[model samples]
Target: MATPSSPFSFLDDLFNRIGERLQPPAWAVHEIQHRAVLFLNHVLQQEPEAQQRLLRQQGRVVRFQWRFVTMEMVATPAGLLDLAPAGSVPELTLTVTDESPFELARATLRGGKPSVQIIGDVQLAAEVNWLVDHVRWDVEDDLARLVGDVPAHTIANGARRVVDALRQFVGGRKPPQAGGPSTGSASTAE
Candidate 1:
């Protein structure tokens, strides 16, 4: 017989099946870390490239990457991490730490964007707007919580603005674009 479908029905059945069996939330201080490798898979669908990047197994490790975007997770005592290419090691790196993926994605744009601190000085609060212009995370909800102490709003707005600017830049460039260091594609660590 075909089962009757309702929006809440699946949830009700799920609760009935596992609510009593599930354990309470764990208080483990996970030091999550992982490597985000970049380079288009050529396939519209991408898959994991290595064992070091698996985030859910244990400890404090979480890595994600796609296209030219990449990140490396180094677990901390608290908060979360949003992965993105900031600069380079010899360069710099940008990260967003917040309560959830949604918060990070939203703050990845706008003026008061997260502080892109290079060394103790160089700060790029507006850098997130740059990421958005290049289609960094695909959508707002697709981001991951890399564990850190980051306010949500800044990341959200910064990402939004970056995407807007990137669209304009690409549309105007239309390939065959020649330039210098200031005009080259962003470099990411895999």
Candidate 2:
């Protein structure tokens, strides 16, 4: 991790420190799942500067907007951890490049996240799509404002806490009743 000397690199250093200090915990998967959904929700609320949303069936909405973005950690070819953020797309129909997307993810998960490119890999992309296809995002807030909220911070902290818990878990230390994502009890309403 780079030193937190510049404003640009401060968050990177913070994440690196967090990753080391917060090893995977028993609740890692659940927290990631929760955060992934929230991130997608946050993204959905962001519209293209000119708006790229549709009013659909039963007054529902469908948007391919690229407003809300978040990060994902993946294993690398060198066996390291890195983080990737989601990219922007004002339109719903994307080119879906196999290598560019997956390679970006692999790089980030491997701890070589590019300073210039902050986007997630397929695993993270799939998670985002799951939320977009199945859940609804709040369309009122921008990404910065949404992420700045108390509730959003709480959710992020929940994710980070659970991930920290998982490192110990994979090592055979289990926390009682950390629970799974299928119990249908989510920290936020979708």
Candidate 3:
């Protein structure tokens, strides 16, 4: 028996088709990569220990791959990140194994790391992992610099609450069943 498809399933199929067909322009991709490197360096600057660790691995390139996007960054002498030169071999490569953006977002909201395929230098990978475990961007501080401390605090608090609510929603929600509508258990729903 063929189960009737839900509206969401139709939308999902449409989006999947669109995503597979559309590719960002090379210039846009390059710009986004440059901006990402700058943001990473900004975060690294906030953590002196992370900088010191990265400085030890200066000149080593690390390539990150997720779906169709690839970004290669090198550790600089100043312990900041910069875009690796074209064709530069990476000392370490980390590929996110998750193919679905929704699944990745759900895992992240649940405070879990996405599955990754790691290759190359073990020490470099360890250092990268340490940085991931230790470093975080201080968005509130940046907002405070732009506005004021009190407003920043209020904004941060509001954002935190919103994130918490999203986490709860994502945690409780069931993934749609293949070939059918989602049939959540009553006990789970409540």
Candidate 4:
């Protein structure tokens, strides 16, 4: 007798094929990375300290990888970033440890940091961490320029509330302290 295919197995196979077909071309990937670099540089330009940090790392190549996508960027003396030349060795590499895009997006929307592994230069990693902790995109300001200030503020507030709700729904509870008593109901009397 032939083995039967499960519905979930069939669905998974279909989705995999669809994803393969929808993947962007190399040039599109390059364009997207270029835009991302531009956006990062714009945000960095707003902070003099961030620019100074980048300036200290000028000529250093940092490679960032998340899943199958990778982008290598070089810090310029002008304290901006540019795409590192192909075949250049990176001085530092940062890899996002989370494999699930949904989980990563949820954490980001919840204002939680995504876990990452750093390899190579320690000073560079520290600088990058400081930048991550301090720098934030001014989405509301950008939106206000496009739309009216009132609408932009309203939209931003709504988005924040939605993200808060999602975070709560995603089990945002903190874990019990190390070596401390359990916080679960089972640990409580009655």
lDDT of 2 at 35: 73
TM-score, cand. 3: 0.83
Tens-place lDDT per residue, model 2, 98-140, is 2233344444444343323224344434433544354444432
Clashing pairs in 3: none
lDDT tens digits by residue: candidate 4, 1-190: 6553543455555655776678889899999999999999999888899999999999999999986679999999999899999998998999999765665766776778889999999999999899999988888988999998999999999997776677677756554456798566664566
lDDT scores for all predictions?
0.35, 0.40, 0.89, 0.85
Question: Each prediction's TM-score against the native?
Answer: 0.20, 0.21, 0.83, 0.77
Q: Is candidate 2 or candidate 4 better by lDDT?
A: 4
**Runs of candidate 3 exceeding 4 Å displacement:** 1-15, 173-190
lDDT score, candidate 2, position 11: 54
Evaluated with TM-score, which candidate comes out highest?
3
Order the candidates by lDDT, highest first: 3, 4, 2, 1
Candidate 2 matches the true fold with a TM-score of 0.21
For model 4, the stretches where C-alpha displacement exceeds 4 angstroms are 1-23, 172-190
lDDT (10s digit) by residue, model 3, range 1-190: 7664543555556667887799889999999999988899999999999999999999999999987789999999999999999999998999999776767888899888999999999999999999988999999999999999999999999999788778878788654455686466545554
Q: Which digits, one per residue and each the tens of the lDDT, describe model 1 over residues 65-102?
A: 32223344432222223332333232234444332332
